[model samples]
Target: MAYKDSSKLLPPPSANDIISVANALNTLKDVKTTWIIGKISLTPGQQKFWFEACENCQKAINVDVGWVMRCPSCKEESRVVARTRVGIAVDDGTGSINTVIFGLDAEKLIPFTTLQFWEAHTR
Candidate 1:
């Protein structure tokens, strides 16, 4: 199979292209991509950053009921930490915003995962 370059498939930059945080925030589209340039800061006094999710479908489980949960999305009975979820503030000169990042992206800013962080601090 021929290895096609993906850069060829992208459209040329348009005037409406999201160039910064302010531009992205002003756009009406529900989803868009842009370079998030800013200093990262954790939300102060924040405790929990992750929740149990269905291993099969990767969705949050019903935690209020406790222990065993039948995942509505996957209909599975088991769940796992799956990954991390974090709330952070980013300021890119033009503006600032609070956003949630998860998985490997979240891991980049944090020194530890949810369980590891809690365990170390609690002990």
Candidate 2:
């Protein structure tokens, strides 16, 4: 399956020096750098990875009747206009990191849209 969206690709490891996931974690806390890791593992339970988030404040929205969602914090009501949020555990042999991908990043990472995946799997 293919997603129908243009995605900005993350820079290649060559452009950003490859580092161990352990080192990446430590340095990330102290400084900012484009550290890359090889052999990323998405882990399991990808079905739970994606969820709906409010478009206005980007917070998780509660689904309501008629395919509508209400944002608790922003108090905004939207009609099925939520974006995808993805959580994954990534490992590069050295260490593992749990990260959440949202917006365009989640769109880029997901090969298929949430609706498409659900429909395909439901049958």
The candidate maximizing lDDT is 1
lDDT tens digits by residue: candidate 1, 1-123: 011221333345665653677876876276544546677788776667665666555566645312566778767785454446788988888888787776556767778876675455446
* Candidate 2 local distance difference test against the native: 0.59
Which lDDT values do the candidates have, in the order given?
A: 0.62, 0.59
Off by over 4 Å in 2: 1-19, 27-35, 64-66, 80-82, 118-123
Give the Cα error of residue 82 in candidate 2, in Å.
Answer: 4.6
Clashing residue pairs in candidate 2 are none
| lDDT for each residue of candidate 2 in 38-116, tens digit (9 for 90 to 100) | 5555656766544555556555555632265666767877554445557767677788877666555676777866555
- Alpha-carbon RMSD, each predicted model: 7.1, 5.7
